[model samples]
Target: MRFLLIEDNVQLASAIVERLSLDGHVVDLAPCLADARAHCATAEYDLILLDIMLPDGDGRTFLADHRGRENATPVIVLTARSEVSDRVGVLDLGADDYIVKPFDFSEFEARCRAVLRRKGGASGNRISRGDLKFDTLAGTLQVAGEQIQLRNRELRLFEIFINAPGQIFSKSKLVDRLFSYDEDVSENAIEVYVGRLRKHLSASAANIVTVRGLGYKLEV
Candidate 1:
């Protein structure tokens, strides 16, 4: 999954980014509210890890503005404030979850998964379509009880498809999800990844189909 982490604490942000990247997530870091807003305006994220106390502005205000515009992207507030009112305030402002500072990484990961599952309408980390299974946590794909070997780009592309089975993804959207901000990748790169993924899934029960003028979607 792709995530935006809005935080100013270098140490904590680094640790979180490292851990999430190790778990096969593409994470973008924004040190302040201004940067976070800029990132949010440009790219779509599966989740947002927002710090309440930001260098430029309050994270709560950002959350309020996000919700005021009817954006439904899930957000998890990361803050040192553990007060009841603080938590309630952020939740009321449309945060899906809240994590206190100095919390366990395991718990943090679990919360992220839970929120993602809720957003994706999935019951668990394993997204299954027919005999094909994509394990979000393990970053593995299995077809008919056999594991399939895939490259990093192939795996990421498959993850996006498996997460939202029949939903059609435009080429531009897929490109955005596959590449990071700093990467100088073109839209054609998405086609290359999709072509490779199609070859890899040839023997599987699931397939990737093009939508002509639209883009691509997973067919099971």
Candidate 2:
């Protein structure tokens, strides 16, 4: 999944980006509300990890404005505030969950999964398409009782196709969903990933179908 991390602490953000990237997630870092807003204006994210105290403005205000505009993207507030009232206030402002600072990385990951599952994402970290089994947590595909592993972004691209099934995704859309803003992507990157994914799914009941002049879709 793609995530937008709105935070100011350079070290913490680096840790977060590294952790999430290791799990095959594309993460974009925004040190302030201005950069965060710019990201939101351009790309879509599966989740937003927002810090309440931002360099340019309060994240609570950003959350309020995001909701005021009817953007229902799930947000989990990452802050140092431990007060019950602070949690309630941010929840009232439209945060799906809250995590106090200095949190364990494992616990933080679990919290993110909890929030995403609550928001109808990857149902319990498992998805079954025909005879193909996907374990989101493991980032592996299981078929015929055999586990097939995928590279990071290839798995991400597969996630997109499985989520929408037959919907034809344009190359640009896949690029947006698979690569982060800071990553250097080539013109034919999607084609390369698609080819790689086809090879991985060779033994499975799933198929990645390409529509000439359009894009690609998943068939199971």
Candidate 3:
């Protein structure tokens, strides 16, 4: 998954980027609201991790403006405020969830996964399509009872297809999904990843099919 992490504390932001990266998520860090806004204008994201107290501005105002612009990207607020009112305030401001400070990384990741599941309309952490079991949080795929270990790029590529089974996803969208803003992508990156995923699923019930000049789709 691709995420925008809006945080001012350099240490905390680096830690978060590292943690999310271990799960195969590409995280872009923004230290202030201005940087956040700039990132939003240029690239799309699956989620946004926002810090309520930023260097330049309050994140609540940004949340209001974000919702005002009809940007439905799911946002999880990272706040030091632990009071009930504080939590409610962010939610009222359109944050999907809030994580208090002094929290463990496990709890943080769990909250992220939960919010993503709700927003994506996925069933629990395990999204099932026919005999295929896809766990977005763990970044693992299982066909019938066989577990297939996917590399990071292959996982990201498969993630896009699993989310929207049977629907065509254009190559341009796939490129955006597979690579981060700063990553260098070759012309055949998508095709190479698709071929790898196809080989992995050859004996399984799921398959990926190309729609001549249109895009690609996952079929079961």
| Model 3, position 40: C-alpha lDDT score | 94
- TM-score versus the correct structure, for each prediction: 0.92, 0.92, 0.93
- lDDT per residue for candidate 1 within 1-220, as digits (tens), equals 6899999999999999999877667899999988998999899998999999988889999999999999999999998999999999999899999999989999999999999989989989888889898877776788878887666677778878987889999989988887777788889999898998887787887889999999999999
Alpha carbon lDDT of each predicted model: 0.89, 0.89, 0.88
**RMSD in Å for all candidates:** 1.7, 1.7, 1.5
Across residues 12-84, which tens digit of lDDT does each residue of candidate 3 receive?
A: 9999999988887888889999999999998888899999898888999999999999999999999999999
Where does model 2 exceed 4 Å of error?
A: none
lDDT of 2: 0.89
Q: Between prediction 1 and prediction 3, which has the larger TM-score? A: 3
Span of 10 residues, lowest total lDDT, candidate 1: 148-157
Selected candidate, larger TM-score, 1 vs 2: 2
lDDT of 3: 0.88
